[model samples]
Target chain A: MAGSNPGCGTTRTFKYQVRDQFGQVMLVYNMQLWDSIVTTSTNTCNLGGYNTTCAITNTGPCNVGTFADGTFNENLGICAPAGHLVSGGCITGCTTTADQTWNINGISLSGDVKNLSYQCDRSW
Target chain B: MYTLLLATLLLQPIWALPPPPSEQGLQVKLRANLENYTVAAETFPQALTKVAAQFEIPMGIEWIRTSATQREIRRSWRHTTVYGVVESLVKSQSGYDFAIANGVIHVFPKGALMDRSSFLNHRINKFEAKNEFAGVLSYRLRELLKRTISPPLPSSPALGTAGSIATGAGDRRITFRLVNASVRQILDKLSLATDFRIWIVTYPEDRTLTETGFRRVASLYTSSSVADNEQPVWAFLRWGDALPK
Candidate 1:
C-alpha cells in the first residue's frame, strides 16, 4: 500500500479494514480517489462501497444484547454507538462541503448535501 | 566513374523484386493436416473467443473447423491455415481452407483457374507491467501463402468466426472449439505470429467479470513467459477470491 501519492489530477486507491479486540480482521473497504487533494478545485474522491468479502466482528465482552454496529458515511463521517467511537476517523470530511460533492464508484452519497442555515454542513 | 556507378545503381530494374518463397507457389499447400493448441492441456474459451473476435477478418473463418476430434483422444488439432485466389468472369474470387496437425495451422486456398499464391507468418511475445503481464505475437502468415504459390491474385472475402462450443468438467477442465473464420480473424487483428500463444488464467471464483481480473491474468502470462525465456505460448483465465482466515 506504500506507493507514490496519486497525481494531483489523477486517481488513487484508498482502503480501510475493521478489526476486533482479538485482532481478528473483519470488514474491509476499498475506494478510488480521483484526486487526493479535495478542495473547491478538486472536490471529489470515490468512496469504496460495501464489501461482502469480510464479516463484521462483534467480539467485545462489554457488548449489550444489541450488537454494536459501525457505519461509515463517505460524506458526513464515521458513526458508532453513543458509547463507542471509531478512534482514527475512518470517515474523512465535514471540514467543508461548500461547492464540494462526494461520490463512491460514480454513485452520489445519499443524504442532505446542505444545512438549513446558510452554512454548509461540511463535517463528517 | 563513381557518378556513372551511382547512376547504374539507380537504374537497377524494379521488376527484380525477389519472387515469393518456393513453398508459396501458385497453389499454396495448406499442409495436408492441422493441429490443435492448448495451455497445459486446457482450452480457454473466453480468451479464445475474445482474441478470435479481435484477430479474424469479417468472413475468413469459413475454412476452419469448430471441433476436429472425437471425445476419446482429444490431443490432435490444427492451428494454421492457407488460402488461394483466382479470377472469374470480370470478378475476382478466392478459396480458403485449413489443415491441422501437431499444434500448427496451415491454410490453403482453392478456386477455379486459381493462379495466385501467398504466404503468412506469425510469432508471439510477452512483457511485464505494474502488477501484471502482457503478451503479443508478431505475425507473417501471408508469406506462407506466397511461398507455397507462384502468383497470387487479390484476396477474396475477409474471415470471421463460424461458431464456438463449450464443455467443462466441474471446476477443473474446460474445452472450447473456435473454428474457421473466427480463428483467422483473431490472428489477423492481433497480427499474432505462430511462435507462441497467449493464455489468460483466471482465479475461478471472481464474481466480477470486469476486465481487471482478466487483464491481470493476461499480464501474469507475459511476465512468467519472459522470465522462462518462453513466449506466452498459451493463456489460462480464471477468477476467484481468497477465503476468510
Candidate 2:
C-alpha cells in the first residue's frame, strides 16, 4: 500500500478464487463502492471510581474502549465489559454525573473531569 | 500652426463609441412569442420601440442607427418566435451582427462583439484538478473489498478413497503468489489485515445456491465492494460534491 491506509476510504475489497476439483480459477467479484461518516473525539473523566461516582459527560453514540482488544464497557460505573468500543471516543453516553465539564459537536455538557492511569497484567 | 491644430483636435469628443454598427453580426434571444410584436410601417428603431412597449420589457436591445438597422423592414410572419423576427430581419439586411444576452439584444456590424481583451472574447475552456483523480483511487479500493479474506482455495494431493464415504474435503488453503496482484489481491490483503467484512449480496439469477463462488449482485449498490470504515464511507459520499458550476 502507498500510504499506511491506501486507496479511497470506502469499503476495502477482498478477492477469492473458486475452483473445480482440478483447481482452475473461476469467477471474480465486481467490487463497487459507497460512502459513510465516522468522526471521533476524546475527553477526561474523574475516575473517582470512573465506574462509580466519577461524572464523565460525553455525547451519546460514543464508546470508551479501554480494554485489551480496545473493546469498551458501556456503563463506566459498572466497570465491566459491556462489549462496546470507542467508535466516537467520548465515553459514549456514559454520563453518570452531570457537571458540564466539556462540549463536543456543539453540544455542551457538565461532568466531573480527572485523568487516571491504567496497568495491565499478562494473562497468557 | 501645430499648436492650433492640436487644440482643435483636443476639443473634439473622442467618439468613445465605435462607428454605428453596419449590418453584419447579430445574435438575439427570443424572450416572447413573435406574434406578440406589433409590426408597424416605421423606422427599424421605431418598430423595435413598439415591440418593447407592447412587451412591457425595458429597452434591453441597444438602438443604433445604421442602414441595416434603420431600414423599414416589414413583418413577414404572422406568428413566430421573438428571435425569428430578429433572424429574419438580419437575413434581409446583410452586413449586420446580432447578439443577445439575458433577453437584451445588440445588433452590430459583423465582428462587433469580438473584443480582443477579456476572457469573454477568448475561447470557452474547461478544467479538472489532479486530486479529482482520487475518484480513480476510490474505484480501485472498491475493487479490492469483495472477497473472502482467507485463502480459500488450495489443492492437496488426494488418495483413492474407499466406496463407503468421503471425509476431510477442502482442508487445504491455497497460498497465492500474485506477480501483478490486482485490486482483488490488494483488497484480499486488506481483509486479512483488518477485521472488516467485504461482501456482495447474491440473487438467484447469479446461479443456484449450490454454485460455489460469489455472484455479482444485480443492484449496483449491492454488487460492489463496501467497507465498515465509517469515515471513508462518508468521504466517498461527498466525492465530487464540491465541483464548481
Candidate 3:
C-alpha cells in the first residue's frame, strides 16, 4: 500500500553560481520550482541566411525558471545542478553592446565602449 | 635681498636638482626606440611579455578570458619605441587598454579600468608588509579586500583555490607601507617590488552580472619564472573546463 501511493513532490529553490574560466564567480542566479522534465530549444544563425547559410539549433532540458534579476532571458537553460556545470561561450572580442558613460575615480570615460557581453554556448 | 636670493637660485646649475622620481623610469623605457619587433602568432599577453622581457621592464596585464584573448596576435613594428608598439597592439584589439603607473605597465580591459564599481578602486586604510614573498603578499591583498569592503564580497571556497604558494630560502621578498591607498595602487606597488612582474587579472564577460561581481571570480596571473615550485595561478582556459584539486 505504501509503495502504491506516492506523495506530492516537494518544491524547492535552487541556486547556481556562474563562474569564469579561472573559476571566479561571475554571477549567481536562483531558480524556483525547477521542473526536471521541462526542455527548451534555441535556434541561432550567422549573418547568412538561416536555411542557405550557417544555422545551429540547441535543445536542452529547461532547468532555469524565473531569474531574480531582469537582465537575463527567462528561458535560459544554462544553470545546471551542483555537479552539472554549464559552459558559457567565450566573448568573441572586446567590443561590447553596453552604451553608457562612466565616471571612474574622478575620470570621466564616455563612449559606446562599455561592458563586454558574453556569447552563450550554443553547443550545449 | 629676496631678489638676490631668487637670482642666485636661478643661476644654479640644473644638474643640482634631484633626478626625476623613480616612477619616470617607466616613461623613459617606454620611449626607448626599437629598430624592429615582430611576433608571428601569440596571445596579447604573450606578445606583450616577449616585448617586456626584451626591454627588461616589469608589466601587469589584466584581461577577460575570452576567445579573443586566445586569438592569435601577429604584428610587426619597425623603427618604433616601446610606447608605439604597445599603443598599436592595444588599439588593434577591441576591449583592451594600458596604463603606466608606479613604474609598471598595466594592460587591462577598458571596461574594468573605467567601471566605477571595480574592486580596484576600493580604498584601504592602511597596508603594511615587511619582507613578504610576492605571492603571499598578493594573497594578503585579496584577503584585505575581502575583509574590508563595506558591503563585503561574496564568500566562496574557490577563493582559497589557488596554485600552491611558493616558499623557500631562495624566494624573493618585498617590503612596503601605504596609508589610504587604493587596491590598484597596492597592486602596482607589488608589481614594482617583485620579480613576478608580469601580472594578469582575467575577468568574466557576462553582461547580466553586476560590475562588482566580476571581482569575485577574477583570476590573477604573474610571472612563471620565480622557481620550480612556483607557478602562475591559472592558465588561459574556458570556465569550468578544469577544476584545481
Provide the overall lDDT of each model, using Cα atoms, as 2-decimal numbers. 0.20, 0.25, 0.41
TM (chain A) per model: 0.19, 0.17, 0.20
Residue lDDT tens for model 3, B85-187: 8889878778788887777777777876666556676678998876555444664565455443322244622111111121211123566799998777777
lDDT of 1 at B40: 19
Give the candidates in order of lDDT, highest first. Answer: 3, 2, 1
Of models 1 and 3, which has the larger lDDT? 3
For candidate 3, the per-residue lDDT at B101 reads 76
Sequence-dependent TM-score of model 2: 0.21
| Model 2 misplaced stretches (Cα beyond 4 Å) | A1-124, B1-38, B58-68, B116-245
lDDT of 2 by residue, B1-245 (tens): 00000011112111122122112221222435665454764455455445433433222222223444546657757678766766665555566556643223444345534533211122212211121112223222332322122111346221110000000111111122334443323323222221111211112122211122222222211222322211011011111111111
lDDT (Cα, tens digit) per residue for candidate 1, span B1-245: 00000011112111222222232331334332234432111222322322233332111111111132101222222454322111110012123333332222333333311221111222212211121001101111221221222222237221110000110110111111223322233343222221122212222211122221111111121122121111112221211111111
Q: Which portions of model 3 show Cα errors greater than 4 Å?
A: A1-124, B1-21, B148-165, B168-171, B207-214, B220-245
Candidate of highest lDDT? 3
Q: Report iRMS values in order.
A: 32.1, 37.8, 28.6
Q: Please give, for residues A7-122, the per-residue lDDT of candidate 1 as tens digits.
A: 11111112222233454542323221111112232112221111111011111111001101111111112122112222432132222112222222233322312111011122
* Complex DockQ per candidate: 0.01, 0.01, 0.01
Lowest lDDT sum, 10 consecutive residues, model 3 chain B, at B1-10
